[model samples]
Structures are given as structure tokens and as C-alpha cells.
Target: MKKVLFAMALALAQTAWADGGMDILKSQCSSCHNLTGPAPQTLKELWARKGPDLFYAGNKYRKEWLVQWLQNPTRIRPAGEFYEDHIKPGEKHDEIDPATLKPHVSLSKDDAQAVADALMTLKPKSDLIAKEKIEEGTISKSMGEMVFDKFLGCMACHRIEPDYGGLSGPELYTAGDRLQPEYIASYIRSPQAWDPKIWMPNKHVSDMNIQKLVHYLEALSQENKNGK
Candidate 1:
């Protein structure tokens, strides 16, 4: 009983220290990132030099993923940027040096949680563009599939099913269900709007086309049976 109690106390102390670790992140990371809102123009337009938006950090990433990424950010982005190739002749990439990041990344275990807590609270006003359902039909379904696989080339890196594409991007077999139509449209139109440097390709999808594509994506998850 004493041993268990002591372990619990140690765990609590670590969490407290981790929670306070936000200062380190703020000092080192904020220069390249925004906690919320539409991305900055300099970063948004750079195409090559950009960073991930942590506005919806809480919702988008698992805690473990964030910790591991902070410790060592590697090929999380297989492609330099969705539109990196357009800016330069060859792909360019950057990452925090493991040696430098190790010391800088450290936090009083308690501070880590606090930092995560603070970051998790960065919610965007446009959280859900809309909540209503649209008419479902064959055209939307077929076109959505084609758009995902060919038009936008989302299949190039994202795995949709029996093997839609490569393993570079996250699995989107359930994007139709997981993502909101509005969010999808916004992201497709400009991934930088959400994250300065996302791995998805930048085909420069237009707003109207983006909407249509998003409709298709919203229908993919197992949760949305009707996909309306």
C-alpha cells in the first residue's frame, strides 16, 4: 500500500511539472506557429516555409503522438509541403535537431500537462462550419471518389481502402465520417489555412470545387451510413 501511494505521488508530481512545460514550447515554437485562427499570410503564402497549426491541437492529435513528435519530428510530412515542389526545383525539409530538442523539450512532468492543457484550449470560431445534412445521391458519391483518387490526388499518399495510395499521409479511409464538410472544403482549398506546413499536396482546389470534394469526403467514415 505504501509503495503504491508513493508511486501515485510521484506520478502526480511529474504531471504537475509537465503541465508547466508550456513555457518552453511557447518560447521555442510560437515563432513558427499559431495556436488558433486563419494562418498568417507570410506563412500561409510561403508554400515552402510553414508549420503546423496547433489551434485544434487538442482535437487533431493524440497526446502520445504529440509527445513523440515533440521529442523527434521526422517524416511526419513525407512531402516537404503540399505545394513545396511548386516553389523550388527540389524538395526542402526542416526538423528540430534531436540533441537540441531533447533538453529544450524537457518539462517538469507536471508542466507538460499544463502546457498540453493550455494548447488544447485553442479552439477556432469556425470549429464546425455547418451541421446540417445535404441531399445524398450517386453523382456526389462517384465524383467524390474520383476527385479523391484522381482530381486532387489525395490517393497518392493517403490509404483509403485495399490500398488507394502510399503510406505517406494519414489514413483517410474514414475521412468522410471523421471530418466536417466545411473543414474539408477549407482544408482542400488551402491546407496552409489550417497548417502552415501540412504534407497534403496543394492542387489549388477552388472554393466551389472544394465544397463538392468535401461533400464526398464527409461520406467516407463508418459512422455516416446515410452520408447525407
Candidate 2:
């Protein structure tokens, strides 16, 4: 009877926690992020989106990373979420002032935790991520760089090496540290499923290459972490 009663109490506590997290999400995050999504099917719909969808946050973000980022918000995308909207025609990348850009909403630590908890519960399509795992240290830095730049053409929009690559997409040099490996693979395989309106196009990359890319990212992040 004691064991049963304790188990019941624990379950009730978990349920209450989840409910509180959901309430926080509905109240604070629903405006900018799509907590529920089918992803935008067209360019017009994509351009209309104000923020990245969070329907797969559970699958995408590391819990600790999310908590830290929420409390101390920073711009992930250098060219803004919609680059076309922020960059004027003929304006150079250096010309845009970071201070002029709209900042992400910051949260208190407690609220951030609650929001993260809620976001993590929004995972969709478990099968998509079931087989994915990061094969760390499998790819050499030079080889990974080649795949990122030559095969994938990711360098066109993203910065793979801080001072290198395009200014449009988020920097990938830190992606390994910032994102989950499964999230990276899933997002690359089908970006539209995560954010229909995102500017990233589906490249139809092979499964083998996707794993390589993830491996490269993890290696790169490790290098950065070690101050290499």
C-alpha cells in the first residue's frame, strides 16, 4: 500500500509539472513560435512566419542549452530570421547594425525552465529520429569541411569556421555544441518538417552524408570546446 501510494503521488506531481509548463508556453511563447505545426508548404507562407517553429523542440534542442539561451537570449541567425526582410538591397553584411535588430525575448531562469519543459513535450514524429545517432570522431576536420562546402553547398549561407562562409545562415562551427545530433540529421533531411517557412531548402542529401555531416559537426564543436 505504501509503495502504491508513493507511486501515485509521484505521478500526480509529474502531471502537475507538465500542466504548469504547458500553461507557461501558451502564455509566453505561442506568439513567436509555432508550438503546433504542419510546416509552411509554400514560399509565401514561409516568408510570413515571424519566428522559427518549436513544434519539434523536444527533438531539436538540448535541455541545458535551451535553459541557458532563454535566460540570456542571443541572435542565432546573423542575417535575421528572414534575411530578405532585414537586409536592404545593396547593403553589405557589415553595414547592418546588430543593435538595430529586434532581440529575442528573455526569460527568468524559473520561467525559462518551465518553457523548456513545455517545449520538450512538443516532439512530433518519433520515428524520424529513432535511428539517428551522432558518430563522433568518424570524420576528419578537412573531410567534413569538404562535405559542408563542396557537396552540400552549406557554405553559401552558413558560417562553418567563424570568419569563413556566407553571412545569411546561422554559424555551424558551434552547431555540434548547440544542437542535438539527431536534430541536426532530421533538420537537414527535411527542414520543412521543422520550419516550413525557413529559408533552408531541402537538399535531398544521402543518409550516409548526413551522418558524416553530423560527425563533422560534433568534431568541430569538440575542437572549439577544447580551444583548438
Kindly list the per-residue Cα lDDT of model 1 for residues 1-228, writing each as its tens digit: 999999999988766655555565577667766654455465445453345566676544446545544554433333323333422332453322322222233444444556666565555634443432334433356777787777767776776553345444555655554444555555666665565545566798765566666556555554234442
CA-lDDT, candidates in order: 0.54, 0.79
Candidate 2: worst-modelled 10 consecutive residues by lDDT:
88-97
Clash total of candidate 1: 26
Candidate 1 ranges beyond 4 A from true positions: 1-19, 36-38, 42-45, 81-114, 129-147, 156-228
For model 2, how does the per-residue alpha-carbon lDDT over 128-174 read when each residue is reduced to its tens digit? Answer: 78867756449888999899899889999887765677767788877
Instruction: Estimate the lDDT of model 2.
Output: 0.79
Error of 2 at 185 (Å): 1.4
Q: After aligning candidate 2 to the native by TM-score, how far in Å is the CA of 71 from where it should be?
A: 1.3
List TM-scores for all candidates, in order. Answer: 0.45, 0.85
Q: Global lDDT for candidate 1?
A: 0.54
Regions of candidate 2 where Cα sits further than 4 Å from its true position: 1-7, 89-95, 131-137
